[model samples]
Target: MGLLTNLKDSVSRVTDRLFASEDPKRIGIYGPPNAGKTTLANRIARDWTGDAIGPESHVPHETRRARRKEGVDIERNGQSVTIDIVDTPGVATKVDYKEFLDHDIEKDDAIRRSREATEGVAEAMHWLREDVDGVIYVLDSTTDPFTQVNTMLIGIIESRDLPVLIFANKIDLDQADIDRVADAFPEHETVPLSALEGDNMDEVYDKIAEYFA
Candidate 1:
């Protein structure tokens, strides 16, 4: 048993080193639905690579697929890191078609959207387990931070030993609270920003370079 444990540890170290040395680390942008994750991802991709990852919508589960933009070279204060930005679908414990119906979506479309969103969430988890090197966990600052889905996702990320930066998005709103989000995840660094208004993006870029690198 001791010898087997040692072998596993050695393999883990080698895997870590290999991933660390690779260029353009894969960084996943993850959060709940309607958290402005796609907005932030579009901002980053446009700023550096002159591209967009996906469309944004006010409705929940708008992003029902994981989108990727490769070779985005982000530089801040002379620190730089090349990364493949993966904007993943929202991680949710429960997705109901009724939520889509509330958005005035028709029955058939709402049900289909719910199914796709659920599959997307599963795909996002798969990426975290096998593909992503780091995580950018976004949260809506206007909402309560203590959620079962949020806790479960963060715990999964921690278990995989992935470096994560929590983003408190939609700070332009009057009800947005950065401190609450920070308090929710005291172990991880949280950055307050309005992804829609392009506020405090420099800090985000700098932190990404610092943490993910």
Candidate 2:
């Protein structure tokens, strides 16, 4: 009996390995500036892969390019899914150099940052159109969820029939309202969590395993 159990366990391990070796799904993290997309991406990457995707910043467009961390394995309830995380620039209809000026950035650098941010938005859209297998749409729970950018982006994702998981981030704040975010997109699942505080991450992981896998 011991020998048989060991053999079965070995086969199960091999099966898990084979499934893990399959092509990883590409999940793009999208949201407006200061919505904590990079924060969440860094959290996910660190939890599984012991790495950071990008730096967090109070300045808008801090992540002026799409940063990708490949092969992150998230496991929950004995289920697992491997994904390539693409941390993208915040999607905004307009990016002005003057906005960075509020952060005390130099004029020349702010202008360059604005240009790069615009380009980054374009790149993010291109990836959504051609590469992304799933989406994690982060939103600031304290803010209104019915912005034009959010509507347009969600519409685009819906049009493509890509799977999406909406994250109502920053629940640690007193003003955070997860229900408001959920009600904005009643058709999809909305998860409430504070990525910075690492609150309710278990649900996030379980949902990722369930939806993206």
lDDT of each: 0.91, 0.92
Go through the candidates in order and give the C-alpha RMSD of each one to the true structure.
Answer: 6.0, 8.2
lDDT of 1 by residue, 10-108 (tens): 576456655777677799999999999999999999999898999999998999999999999998777567899999999899999999998889999
lDDT for 17 (candidate 1): 51
Whole-model lDDT for model 1 versus the true structure? 0.91
TM-scores for the candidates? 0.89, 0.90
Error of 1 at 202 (Å): 0.7
Q: What lDDT does model 2 reach?
A: 0.92
**Local accuracy of candidate 2 as per-residue lDDT tens digits, 1-213:** 277865764576456556754698899999899999999999999999999999999899999889999999998777777899999999999999999998989999999999999999999899989989889999999999999999999999999988789999999999999999999998778999999999999999988876677
